[model samples]
Structures are given as structure tokens and as C-alpha cells.
Target chain A: MLQQLSAQELPKVEQEMTDFITQYTTQEDLKKSMLYSIEAGGKRIRPLIVLATVQAFQKTLNAPVYQTAGALEMIHTYSLIHDDLPAMDDDDLRRGKPTNHKVFGEALAILAGDGLLTGAFQLISETTLEPTENVLLIQLLAKAAGIGGMVAGQAGDMAAEHQQVSLGELKAIHRGKTGALLTYAFVAGGILAQQPAYVLTLLEKLGGHIGLAFQIRDDLLDVVGTTEALGKQVGQDEKSAKSTYPALLSVAGAKDALEQELAQAQATIEQLTKAAGFQPQVFQELLALFTL
Target chain B: MLQQLSAQELPKVEQEMTDFITQYTTQEDLKKSMLYSIEAGGKRIRPLIVLATVQAFQKTLNAPVYQTAGALEMIHTYSLIHDDLPAMDDDDLRRGKPTNHKVFGEALAILAGDGLLTGAFQLISETTLEPTENVLLIQLLAKAAGIGGMVAGQAGDMAAEHQQVSLGELKAIHRGKTGALLTYAFVAGGILAQQPAYVLTLLEKLGGHIGLAFQIRDDLLDVVGTTEALGKQVGQDEKSAKSTYPALLSVAGAKDALEQELAQAQATIEQLTKAAGFQPQVFQELLALFTL
Candidate 1:
């Protein structure tokens, strides 16, 4: 199910992203650095999630949906670019390619990330959505990706490096660092679809659970997955003494947590589907993507 | 005239900025770093420009105007934070205080800048404006602050470091780096006031000339101003081999250029006042702030 959706939607998302990015025709090198990181492919999972959630709501996918999805991807990509900076994670490799700073120097890399981030806001704000909807979407995206969300998580994660942290601390870090934007992706779809308050609430819950499950899976993958499979270095968290779910909870425990979160996510989606009286098969299929 | 406006409006801008920034009630450390940079005051020039432009149109100041002003200041502060990173300008002092990275670690400083940039969008998008207006403001702000505007200029400026750049290249850099946002400030005020196209066009022109004049004056200040007076190290641009206007054009030539730009800016404002049929005494007063 995810494959079919990705095959259909990923190309469109890429096209929209490309079109939006190319609008800045000046600053060839800066544009190149931005395009390089963005064009470097990933699962495009966040955007797919957005499309799926909108589809689940029986809303016809439109420009606003695609642009919002593209914007989220841009934000995600920008964070990754900055995260890979020498002052941060200092990784030289991402997606089996040299990190942004490696290809373009640190200054350009930072600016490229800034460019993408600011561009994301531009894309969303300029979307054809109603003013109230645009406001809601921007508010959600900002809070999720801004200080209260991803940035805070990053700060905490960096601060906790080489230090022992409680399981609670690990959960908080994971929620903000990885969960906020992911959750926003799901909730933003709901916003675009004009989902009712109850439906939106359920979607947020579902997003939270999926976010935890996705992050735990990532921690597990880092521990057990090979560099070839992960497309980046493995065991990085351990090497840097950064706390991870698998580290805080043993591997078996982490797997259990992932299972629990996935189950919770499924339950919430079921509730949402029944309450909203819509088919959520696509959502279910998307959820399955998180499973081992 | 500048003093009277600052005395009345500067405090209000500061208060609004403080109120808006303190809304991030979580991640205490991250919030502190953000507030630290924000509270370490400059002249509040950008926000003041925004406010002054709005007043020039005789619009009763409202929440949206103050919020937009605050947002621009946040963007400016964020850019300074990022520009001062060791990878970029590498300055340790700003406004006679330790740069953000000096006080907060480089990681936190980067995150703080990100927070403020994101927060700026939140402040604007969440404003209680009509949807079309909000969209226009966001588009203008994003374009001015994004890749096509300030970020592009910064990239060009950085790329030109230690290299001999032509006069055309220098103007292009100044336009994006400095002119874009300044122009946006004027245009945004016109937007908020619902000024006609002719007025907005004039404001854009006014902003462009002022932005050029402001930058040239900065270059001159670097060449001649004292550290105690300027609140930053002088001659640092020369020390770093940055291609300033005075470097490419002789000091006298740079001053001549500044005068030309200022005169053009005054003419544009004069035309705007006549066309829009409003007293632009406040705007003329504001322009005086840029003079040596």
C-alpha cells in the first residue's frame, strides 16, 4: 500500500518541491546547494502521510495539500542539513552522499538550510488555502518545527550528549526531536481537510503514537541495521554516547514499546475512521509502513 | 525627530517583542537563549521602521502591526545570531555583548536563531488579518527574508570574502542582504495600511534607496566610526577582506553614493506623500536616523 502511494504521490511531491525551489533563480550556488539536498531522495514519508490523511478524509487532493506536504518535506530536509553540520552531529554522510556542509561549505550549508526553512513558510503562506486555514497550518507548522518543538528537542538532545538521561528524558527528546514535525504532518492533513475537532484530536493522538514508534524503530535500526541498509553510519548514537530508546530500554524493551505505540496508533485511527464515517484504509496502510 | 519617535515607540516595540518571545514556555534553556539575544538590544531599527511606516500612512496602530514589527526584529536578530557563528562572520562581539554562540554554545545559538526565524512566521501567520492580506504579508516577508532576499545576499557576501568582487556584484549583494528586508518593512506597512499599489511601489523604491544608503553608511562607519560609538569592532570588514562599498569605491565615492541613495529615497517618499495625500513627516524623521 505504501509502495503504491509512494509511486503515485512521490513524483508529484518532487515536482511541486522543484517548482517552488526554482522560483529563486538567482544565487545559483545557493540554489544548487538547496536543490542538491532536497533532490537527494528519501522515502518522502512525511509528504505521503499528509496525502494519505487528506485522502482518508475523502478530501480531493489539491494544490494546498501538495504544497503543504512539500513544505513539510522542505522543513524536514532543512533540519537534517543543519543537524549534519559539524557543530551539531558532525556527520559527513547522509543518504549515502556527502552531507550538505561537505558538498557546500558550512556557511552555505547553514544558509541553504535557512533558505529551505524560510521557503517552506513562503510555500505554505502563499498556498490557496483560506486565511483561517493558512493561519492554522502556519501556527501548527511553526510550533511543531520551531522552538517549542523540533529545535527544543535538538537542543536537549545535544545537551544530553555523553550524559546519562532518564527514560522519561529520552521520551521527551524523541517526541520533540522527531515526533513534532511528524505529528504536524498528520495534523496538518486534518487541518487541510477541515476535519472536525474530534477528528483532529484523534489524528494528533495517532501522530504522537506513530512518531514514538517511528523513532524507536529508528533507534533500533541504528543499533542493528547495517550502514548499507540505513544509508548512513550505524551505531552513531552509541558512539556519541547519546541516549536512545533502545539504550534506555534494552533492545527487547524498545521493541515492546514500539509494538505498544503502533497498537495505540492503530486503535486511534480506527476510532477516527468510525467517528468520521470515512474509509481510512490508506491510513492503515501507511501505519503498516512503521512496522518491522 | 528620531529621538521623539524612539522614546514613544521603541519601548512599545520592546514590550511587544518580549511578550511574543516569552510565549515559548517550554524548553527553559532554549527560551532563555532566545530571550537573551532578543533582550540584548540594538536600536530596534527594523521594528521601528515597520512601526514608522505604518504611522506614515496614518493607520491606527493595531496588534497585527505590532506583531509584524516584532517579527521583523526577530528575523534581524536571528540573522545576526547565525551570521556571528564561527563558520560565518565569526565575530565574538555584538552590541558590545558576547555573541550568541559565545554565551550559548554553538548548537544552542543555532537552535536559538532557528527558533526566532520560525517564531517570526508564527507571529505573522497568526495575526488577525484577512486571509488575502495575511497571505500577501507572508509572501512579502518570506521573499524578502528568504532565498531571493536576505539569505541570498548573505551567501553572496560570504562567497565574496577575501575575493575581489566587482561593483555590480557588491550592489547585488547589498540589495539582497540588506535591501530586501528593509524594502519589505516599508511595503509591509503599506500592506497593513491597505495602501494603493502606487504607494506600495513608492515605498518599495524608498526602501531600496534607504537600504542602499543604510549599507553604504555602515561601510563608512566601519571605515571611520569608533568601536565605543558603533558598539561593534571597526575596520573588521577590512580585516576580513570583505568587499564593502568603500573598498570597491573610494571612501569619498562611497559617501557620494550614500548621498545619492538618500536623496533618491527622500524623493520617493516625497512622491508617495503627494500621491497618497498624507503627511510623511514621520518617514522623513525616520530617514534622518540613517544619516551620519
Candidate 2:
């Protein structure tokens, strides 16, 4: 089911993101780096989750919200660009190609990342979302992306280099680095739909749980999967002494945690599914992406 | 006058920026990088320009625009961080200290730069300004920082690297890269005051011309100023084979161009100052910053 939906729906998500990225970035070098990082090709999962989550909430996607979803993908792309920089992960390889810095050189890569990151806000602010809602969404995105969220996570990740870390510490890092933005995505969708604050809070928690599980699954896969299968250098986490769930937990234990977290995430959405005006298929589809 | 004003006002600008930066970043490594770049320090000229521009416009010095002004300095700081990366100019020193990547390592440095850039948006979005004005301020800020402004100019600079560039091409790059944001500062004050579009437009033009002269002066200083005076490594541009106005035009020629541009910029503001609601002294004070 996951494969089937990704095959059908993921392509549309990629197209939408490509269209959005191309709009603000037209410089050849910038386009080269943006396409290099963005088109290097992943599952386009974040944006799909956004689209699916919005659909599940029974709101038709409007232009402003659609643009916000695209901006989320750009933010995701920018993170990848920096994560793969030589000063950071320093991996020459990403998604089976030379990393952004490798292809574009370091200065352009840094600027490309900077451009992508700043460009995301330009995309969001320019969206025609209602002023108050737009302001709220901007705040949510800023909080998720700034020191309180992604930056904090990155700081923690950097600090963990060559240092021992507990499972809880690792979870905290992933939760900020990866989960904060994901949580913001769902909360953004909920806010856009004018859902009640209670619903938005639940979605934020659910998204957070899923984002944590996603990172753990990624960690586990890195230990077991080939570099080609994972789309980048695998097992580098151990090389870099970077902490991961599988590094802290036994593989069996990590898998068990993922299962528990996944169940909780599903339960949150299940309640919504049974509620009036919910779209169960979207939630079901999102869960299926990870279960496989 | 310059030294006295700079001494009194510069520390406040530096302290405000430091406070804003500290709130978002505390990872020791990230802080090391952020501090390495920010603490390396300049005259706090950009933020001072912002505040002085506001003061010139008759706004109280303690107005909320001060926060917005500080945010602009963060953007400036981030640009320097990226520009000094191994990929771009590859400088190890900025303002006489190790560059961000040099002191903190590349990864943390990269993230620190990212943190500052993203934090700027977060800062502005969370400001206590009203939504209507906030949206407009963000639009102006983003344009200045993003593709049509700073980023675009950076791209032009990169493209022209090691190549022969015309005086016109150089001016365009400087205008976009440096001038846009500086212009945004002047226009931003007018914006916050709800100044008419015509007034804002005049300030914008004034900023553009002054910006060109500022860059020209900078290029001239590269040829003449000591490292002690500039607080950065001297002659780095010539080493990089990057073209500058002084390199493209003789020192005397560049100086001549600066005088012409400065005069034209002052003339435009002088015209605006004569209007009933417009204040000539405000613009005269702003222009006087460059004259000495």
C-alpha cells in the first residue's frame, strides 16, 4: 500500500516542490545547487505527509497553504544541503551523487543552502494566506526552524560528536533536528484548516512522535542497509561517532521503540479518523509508509 | 564626531545583536562558531545605519524598530559567515579572529551560520509589531535579503570572480549585494513610520546610490587601508583574483566615481527634503555619515 501510494502520489509531490523551488531560484549556480540537493531525489515524504494530513483533515488545499507545504520541502532540502557539507557530515556522497558542496564547490554550496533557507520564508510570506493565519504559520515555522528547534538539534548533534550519548539524549536530538519541523507541518495544516487548538496540539504531539520514530528507523536502516539502498553513505554514524537510536539501543530494542511510537502516532490519528469529516485514508497511508 | 557617535552607539548595537543571537543558540560548539564570527566584530555599522536612519526620520531612538534593526545585523553577520567558508573566499580570518568554520570546524560553523540567518526571520516575526506593518516589513526585509537583493548580488559577485568586469557590472553587483539591504534600512524606517510610497522610494534610491559609493570606498580601502584600520586581512580580494572597482578602475577613477555617485544620491534626498511633510535634516544627517 505504501509503495502503491508513493508511486502514485509521491511523483505529484515532487513535481509541486520542483515547481515551487524553481520559482524563486533562477541563478544558474543556485538552480544547479538547489536541483542538486532537491533533485538528488528522496521519497518527497515530508511534503506528501503535509498534503495527506491536510486532506485527512477534510480541508481542500488552497493556494496559500499549498505554497506553505512547498516551503516546508524547501526547508527540508536546505537542511540536507547543510548536513552534507564537508564541515558537517563531509560526505562526498548523497543520494548516489556528489554532495552539493562536492558538485558546486563549498562557497556556492553554503550560499545555495543559505539561499534555500531564506527562500523558504520568501515563499511563505508571499503566500496569500489570511494575514493572521500567515503570521501564525510564520511564527510556527520560525520556531521550528530556529534555535528552539532545528538549530538546537544541530547544536546537540555537533556536541555529541566523539561523546557518549544516552538513548534519551539521542531522541532529544532527533526530535529537534527532524521532528520539530514535522510537528510544525501538521500543526500548520491544522491551523490552516482553522481547527480547534486541542486538535492542533494533538497533531503536534502525534507529528513529534512520528518524527522521532522516523529517525530511529533511519538509524536502524543505516546499520543494516547498504549505502545504495539508503541513498547515501551508510554506517557513517558510527564512523563519525554520531549518536543514533541503534547506536544507543540494541537493534531489537530500537525496533521495539519504533513500534511503540508508531502505534501511539497511529492512535492519535485514529481518533481523528473516527470523528466527523475525517479522511482515514490519508492517515492510513502515512502509517503504511513507515510500517513497511 | 564619527568616533564619538560610533563609540556611544556602536556598543548598544553590538549588545543588542549579542543578546538576540544568544537567545537562539547555546550549543557550546555552535556558540563558539557564532561568537567567533560575531565577536570578531566590525563598527556595528549596518545596525547603526538602521537606527540612525530611524532617528533621522524623527522616530524616537528607543522605538520597537530597534529590534528589527538588530535583525538586519544578524543577516549581515550570516553573510560574512558564509562568505568566509572554505568554498567561497576561504579566508581564515575575519576582523582579526578565526573565521567561523576555522574556530568551530566546518559543520558547526555552517549550522551556526544557518542558525543566524534563520534566527533573523524568527526574530522579526516574533516582534511586537502589528500584523499589518509586520507583513509589510517582512516583505521588504525578505526582498532585500533574498534573490532580488543580497543573494542576487552575491551571485553576481561569484559570477564575476576572476573575470574582467565592467564598471557598470560592478555597480550592479554592489547595488544588489550591499546596496539593497542598506537601502532597505532607510526604506524600512520610512516603512515603520508609515511614510508615503514616494518618500520611501526616494530613500530607496538614496540608499542605492550611497551603497554603490560605500562599496567603491571599500574597494578603495582594500588598496589603501591597513589591517589595523579595517580589522580584517588586507589584500585578500586581490589574492582571490576577485575584481573590485579599484582593480577595474584606477584608484583615482574609483574615487571620482564615488564622488559622483554620492553627489547624485545627496541630490535625490535633497529634492525629497524640500517637500512639506519630508524632513531634510534627517536625510542630511544620513548623507553626512558617508561624507567624512
Lowest summed-lDDT stretch of 10 residues in model 1 chain B? B1-10
For all the predictions, what are the DockQ values?
0.74, 0.59
- Give interface RMSD (Å), model 2: 1.8
CAPRI category for model 1: medium
Tens digit per residue, CA lDDT, model 2, B163-189: 998887888788878998898887887
Residue B159 in model 1: shift from native, Å? 1.8
- Report candidate 1's interface RMSD in Å: 1.3
lDDT of 1 by residue, B1-292 (tens): 4576578777776777778778763587788899999999987877778878877877777888888888888999999999999999888888889999999888888889999999898888777888778878888888999999999999988878789999999999999998999999998988988998988899899999999999999999999899898767799888888899899899999989988998898888778867564677888888887887
Could you give the fnat of all candidates in order? 0.72, 0.59
**Highest lDDT model number:** 1
lDDT of each: 0.87, 0.76
**Per-structure clash totals for the candidates:** 0, 3
